[model samples]
Target: MDAFTTAWAGLTGWIFETLVQPAFYALGLMDWAEDAYDWLDFGLYGLLTIAIVYLVCRPLEAWRPVEPVADRRAIRTDMVYTFLARLGVLPLLAFVLLASLQTRWEGWLTEEGLLPPTLEEIFPPLRAAPLLAFLVYVVVLDFGEYWRHRAQHGLRWWWALHAIHHAQRQMTFWTDDRNHILDDVLAALWFGGIALLIGVPPGQFPFILLVLRLAESMSHANVRLSYGRLGERLVVSPRFHRLHHGELSAGAAGKNYAVLLPVWDWIFGTADWNRDAYPRTGAPGTEEAMATGGWVRQQWAGFRRVALALAGRG
Candidate 1:
């Protein structure tokens, strides 16, 4: 891992200096160099994650695909979402907003001279073990993700936006990030707030994010595979998550909401332990445009649905 990271750092540095730095220098935006570097790190990680996922899951899909890729166009659309999301256009917007949006979001308690303590403050032992602390932060953030995914289903308006994600009938590894823009912002706030509360460093944010994202992409892969009984219970399996995206399992009646761990679903009565089930993926009662449309069309459709849901007219 050390050797690999060193090599990766060299590669990323070269790319940034050769392309990114010169562009910033030309534009006289040297002041944004640090943020630009961070953005570059994000882009590098995103590319790595995509390549890794493709290398690992693409073959599995070919070997034991549960469903055939009869709709290449839909998969292509998801690929665009994945690239746009991770390349830092939409996600960068969310990262920049996190500080201002969550500065004092503890509500009246913040006004009452009470504030939340970081995990390190609560458990001083964590300070000495930064790696362990980061893992703990990952666990905490994953727990928060479990609930945020629930809210995406349980809340009508949120689900209106989240429905764009489930509308992918031709779900693939690329489909993990096929979300509405508003839904993406909400996810950023949910994830960023949890990160801040747990005292995760901005530097370590991408690491945990990479782990979760890899798991998510694997889960959504077309592979017809499971991690055995105990392993499935311990961590989310493709079979476990495919059930969550099953035709009948979407919306408020969703199941298997855990992002990284299946334990949350097991504990919360949302787990479907039938290891043999791999029903077709997609949401019901949605227009075809959302499932098959271009990125902008889907975003517009999601906004309209959210407005309708909010108005109690859906």
Candidate 2:
């Protein structure tokens, strides 16, 4: 892990110095250098994640697809969402906004001589076992994600934005990132806030994110596969999550809200353990534009829906 981290740092630093730093220099944005560096790191990791997800998921999708590739255009639009959300403007903006806030908050707490609470601090034994500490952080963050997903469905206005994700009839690995920008922002806040509260170490943040994202991507893959009865209860399977996206399972009626672990859903009574069910996936009653339109159209439709929902006219 240390070797990999070192190599990743070296590559990111070289890219920043060679390309990004010079571009920032020309734009007279040297003041934003620190944040820009972090953004670059995130973008690089996003690129790596995309490649890995594609290589791992594409074959499974081809092997046992639940649905045929009928709408190439919709899949392409999802790819646009994947690229934009992962490695484009979103990363830069999220880093600039959230990183600064974290820095100021942590600095303030430090000058007051107060340490932020962490799992290690809560359980001293974990402090000596870095791997166990990392796993605990993963579980904690995933628990937070499970609740956030439930809220997205339970809340009317949030569902207005989240509907864009479920609107896809052609769900693929790329579909994992098909979310409204506002929805994405709320998710980022929900995730980053949990990390802050638990005091997840800075170094562990990237790997934790990578693990969760890979699991999500695989869960969204258009594959006819399951982890069997007992295995399905352990980790989320494609069959399990496909049921969550089934046409009948949208909005507040949805099940299988867990991101990585099905245990959360099992414990919370949201688990659907029917391993043979790979029902058709889509959000019924979604706007046509949101279901099949291009990137800008989907975003606009989601925005319009949320606006109406907020106004109580949806």
Candidate 3:
């Protein structure tokens, strides 16, 4: 392994030994010394697995031909909007952080108490069980996320929050974060709440979030990274996700919405792989439809639209 990989492994090992092990011991689950063994196994094994994935997948992504689109000014505008919208996530983040701190401070909450106990908590039989569990949880959460994405398209109220994401006329990595604060809040609540209720471990939560963010960033990246059939089945590709943002007429608006997995869309009959026949991708509704009195006015208009629908006004 290279210096960076070695350092990462070492750090991961240390974290498992110091933090994870102690937590397990406090829960009266395992001996403290086992933590060291767990750390070393996870650090080395995890590093090797990720390294192999990158080595094999990176080249395939590079070989795909991607069409280039230039619209810097529009992209920049979208970035600004996204940045502004992300500011809304701060309060929600704070709420989650506070809840975490409270759970930790209480001391009554064991590792298992947290939704989705970490691999270590779930499988104490084998040293490698935690590592295996970690991988399983990643896939499971991705599956869950795919359904959540589909719901956002199928439900009208959910679409209100998701529409903020599609508001951008341009696409880029940062464009992925461009969403209304309410939308971000609802998304966090939906995914995190469901994961917690299902007992997903807190330790594993970070890994899940990291994987999702990496997928989101990669899918929105300007560079092309198509993995053809194999990639399509395994993970969501940029092309598959781009179809979700396709600008179609009213009749064909909410088509593809799966995030990390395409299976959900395919299963639900929402998959759209007709790249050659896809309409030009853009935000739905006209510029005038988006333009209200101002930002506040537009926001109010959106709120009113939702309220009216709830009251059966629309």
Best by TM-score: 2
On a 0 to 100 scale, what is the lDDT of residue 244 in model 3?
Answer: 66
Structural RMSD, model 1: 2.8
Model 1, 129-216: lDDT tens digits are 8777777877788889899999999999999999899999998888988999998988888888777666565566556666677788
lDDT (10s digit) by residue, model 2, range 1-314: 88988999899999999999999999999997876887788778889989988988999999999989999999999999899987858756665577787888889899999877888888999989888888888888889999999999999999999999999999988899999999988988888888778876665477667777888899999999998878888888899999999999999999999989999998999988888898999999989998999999999999999999999999
Strongest candidate by lDDT: 2
Clashing pairs in 1: none
For model 2, the superposed segments whose C-alpha errors exceed 4 Å read: 1-10, 26-28, 107-113, 204-209
User: Lowest-lDDT window of 10 residues in candidate 2?
Assistant: 200-209
The models' CA-based lDDT, in order, is: 0.87, 0.89, 0.56
TM-score: which is higher, 1 or 2?
Answer: 2
lDDT computed for candidate 2: 0.89
User: 168-252, model 3: which lDDT tens digit per residue?
Assistant: 4456565665555555666666666555544454354334554665676566544455557667756777776666666762213
State TM-scores per candidate.
0.91, 0.92, 0.62
What overall lDDT, based on C-alpha atoms, would model 3 receive against the true structure?
0.56
Instruction: Report the number of clashing residue pairs per model.
Output: 0, 0, 7
